[model samples]
Target: MSTAVGGTTRPCPECGARVPVDERFTVWCAACDWNVDPGERQEHRQKQETEKRRAKRPGQGRLEEARRALARRHGERLHTEMTRDGADLRARRDGASVLAYALALAVHGVTAALLAGGVLCLVWGWGGGLMLLGAVLLVMAVALRPRLSPPLGDGTVLRRADAPELYALVDEVARAVGTRGVDTISVGKEINASVISRGLRGRRALDLGLPLWEVLTPQQRVALLGHELGHYANGDTRHGRVVGSALRSLATWRYYFLPTPRPSLGEMIVNAVYAVPLLLVQGTLSLLDHLTLRATQRAEYLADREAARTASTEAAAGLMDQMLVLDSIDVFLRRESNNAALAGARSARRNAAGAREGGDLWTRLAAHLASVPEHEYERQRRAGARRGHSVDSTHPPTHLRRAFLLTGPPAEPAVVLDEAKQRRIAAELATARAEVARSIVRDGVA
Candidate 1:
């Protein structure tokens, strides 16, 4: 007997895979890739062509052109700086790389001097009351240092035992890159990986994005992890600890120095008078921040170089491309996944199995991502490439990184997990995925 083609009950005639009928009236078996209509293919091609033409219109390239010009200018200076810095590092002087550190020290030193001078004035100045006021101003300057900690993402910490496969990979990368091994690993929903200092001991914590892991090939995953771990080896994350502390301190001091509460006219006068010295400190920090921005960008390139060395350059470039896609859609996908999970939670028991891909959140997300057409992905990739290396941007432009990677000698693939191992690693994270999804929904990622 011949199989029917129009209903969910029937399978595809050629491959016998289930062909679920939908309102679109396009008959096909997605599982076995059979019986796609010619009209549908033609329709898709036409739609893509139309979108492509629209994207290439005259005004479309205007902003990109301007950005590229600016990027070229910044790239020239960056090339010079990185060249010099690289030579210095090769000479074993990276620890003393010129930074805004000196300025940060100066800012703190000035604050202490002001406080000490104010104390002296309070003891012996012309008027005791005026000197007391000066002392208070100086004290406030020192107390209100910028103190924001880096954001610890909303997710669960997975110990080495819990994610041994991942920890093993971390160990391999750490050994290859010659950096301290990660002290802890956390699974989070971010579309990016980050290495953060965990405690007073500065033990490195590695945060991996589960969604990011889902999309990347094993080699690309190595590239991603290697890139983050590379930061430690390259001394970029270390510099971050130094500069970040200073920047945070400046912010804390700025906050205290800035007037708080609703001040009456008389109080406002006093507050404004006190703000004069505080503004100088803020201005000095701002200038230092401006000067050091390029150093941060160069650090990113240096880290990329390390990743390319550890993982193949191709994998590193592929990571940059994938990251562009993630940056574009991560929030949207997270919200959609949350919505799907919430809906599934409210469904009948029978409907639970009916939920897409056996009610797996990651599977549902993969399906949603698969629905984005190739051209849309290309569009975002191109857009990211065009954003150009701005001076203030921490990461260099994706195109620039790709270009730099291509210039280097090709690297052997550093990490490759067999298919079974990849599946095993993913299976180990199944429970964590559920926990993370619940966290996302609980935290209301949307």
Candidate 2:
């Protein structure tokens, strides 16, 4: 039988063993395990053969050699072009992170300083103290906000294994782009998701509500996760958290000086003395809160782009569509619940009317105060009343968020998806919905 190696025939160079002529040209000598330069050997052989043939047709070989050289040069040029494009993308991403950090810090510092100044002015009996106080209170509320942490395990692969298919999709996209895996995936009742990061270390996590799972298709879920993850990838979490904490501390200081209802007259007097400064503090906090929220809005836009980059543009659009539908459903539910509660409250008031009218002057005054419009009341009173608490909460209004996500400018590289993938996603979504329904039914039975 004939054997071949390296397209040549020769005696074995490494050993005195008699081998097939073709096998002697192997890249590695079988007997001694010595390495051979295949390319160099092939080139040497070609050159020798060409030299032998050159005597017959020297001009003909030149054209073939030149064509080979041209092809190598073209390949080198293409490789260089690809490398330059990759570098340009990296530069742009880095620039974005730098800009986001600067904006976050500036907003935080300005808000804190304004709040301190306002409090000082209020202490000096400034006329705008009340307004200042209100503003400061608002700022503190946003700046001092605490986010719920999503629980995650230690191992990345293991944690991902426990996640839903949507989360897995997020992980794949992130890994493909050489970004960090999502920190956590939490299930909540509301149809919402958010990314949060804290401390100087930049520890981040993502919260995804169970209700959102029910509402969104698989592709939409992937897009939403991509958006939240993008915020982390963009380094928004750590910076945003720092800004929030600073604002909160300033607000807390202002609130500390504000008077609250107490049993002792001396305490009331003491609180009253600090009222002006407290009001100013409140105003400063409010301004900070407004700025923070605005920054949040911008971050949201950036995140949307990131999502589009990780997933398809259509996936991003689908996410927005699902969010809008969920918001509408939530609004309807809230309105219905509110109407029911109001009716129940009216009935309770009617029942308590006879008993409430029969009290001492102080008691009657307290009862009358409780009946006052909540929106016009002091912060403490409004908080205590608990009359439709959701309306007064921080976080962007749902309708506005949905609108922005749907219509926001494309700010990152576009991703593409095909019809087969879309079909598979739809099938997965159907399965998820069925599983959810089964679980709900099982729970009801139990």
Candidate 3:
């Protein structure tokens, strides 16, 4: 028998070795599982065998390699396209922010003018004074509005003085991305990390909370930071601040006209007199908030893509999963806290009963106040408290985000785990849970 190599065939030197030749001049020996080369006389035989193998294993190694090369090239192309798209988005957002600021200033200017006119009208006993006063109050409320800060900034660097391991990890990631180190890092109660830009010129800062440090694994923490850094890389932080400020201003103006109780009888009189104007202000603010939210949603999508690009998609997915788990834990804790509070209230009531025999004047007053229909008020109060929580909740709902990250392009499949990746993800989850348990044991979370 003859085998072929490189367009030639020759007799196999090794007897009893099964020599199979191919058209491409490749030879396979079955008995010894080695390739053999036979010189030119067997070339026709070699070609026929090669054709058989090609038919049997269509588009094997070389073809697969070509496909992979094409995919890598495509990925590079997409990265470039996305980078340019991100730049365009940043430019557009910057313009929008400037426009919003300008509009806010214009509104403020009009408000100032109206207030001046109102004062003059007050001096002259003009009927327009009330309308002008309402407008002025609305503007003041809008101008001084407060809101949850946007979750963007250069994150605080974990120092050796604070958390050595976390600091080291953050430094590693920062070096990998070739960015300036996080500007600041602080320990906070909420399980969140954010990048914030401050001052008129927007100096960047990173703020990390203590709960995240206590809860997340090093991988999870790095992933979370990468997501935030993605925001920074895309200039989302500065633009987010502008959007947040604009939304806050609108919300304030809306609240000014809404039916919240007045601080005093005189204020109530003024509010009642100018209710219609207040409603208009509130309506306008609500419209602005809707628009800002739309922009915010787009920024979130871009940031997610950036995170996936910089880190692995799996890492981004892991971070989002961790966020959802943390959110559930927070909700559970909040409910438990509320229950504890109710128990404390009951204990206080019993103590009051013991002290007063039945009910004293103060107790009766408290009972009467509690008996008033205030379900809406209580709900609003709770919502306000949740808003005041230090956690950076600027992102959309967790479940929605997870779905977005997990689903990738259909054509180029992601690594489908055959047990190993699944195990690793499970181990990570277990570690996170253990950390949370340990933190609870040590700190006795309230």
Q: Give per-residue CA lDDT, model 1, range 47-76, as digits (tens).
A: 577567658775544554565576568776
Per-residue lDDT, model 1, residue 389, is: 58
The candidate, 1 or 2, that scores higher on TM-score is 1
Q: By descending lDDT, how would the candidates be arranged?
A: 1, 3, 2
Please tell me which model should have the higher TM-score, number 1 or number 3.
1
lDDT tens digits by residue: candidate 3, 37-59: 22333755765776777788986
Put down candidate 2 lDDT per residue, 1-446, tens digits, no spaces: 23445233334567744333332123343354333334455767988898778779977578656644553443334223323423322212234345544554654655556666556656654566565775675576455433323234221121444545545565676664446765554443344666565445545566555446545555566677677776656544333565555554554566567677763888878887888878766766555554444334345555665676666556776565454344344543343334434544665553343233222312332233333322222222222222211221332333333334445344343333346665654354443333332322222111
Give residue 159's error in model 3 in angstroms. Answer: 6.9
Question: Model 2: which ten-residue window has the lowest total lDDT?
Answer: 383-392
Q: Identify the leading candidate in terms of lDDT.
A: 1
lDDT of 3: 0.48
Model 1 bad stretches (over 4 Å) = 1-72, 76-99, 108-151, 237-240, 255-271, 274-278, 334-359, 370-374, 441-443
Compared with the true structure, all predictions reach lDDT values of 0.65, 0.47, 0.48
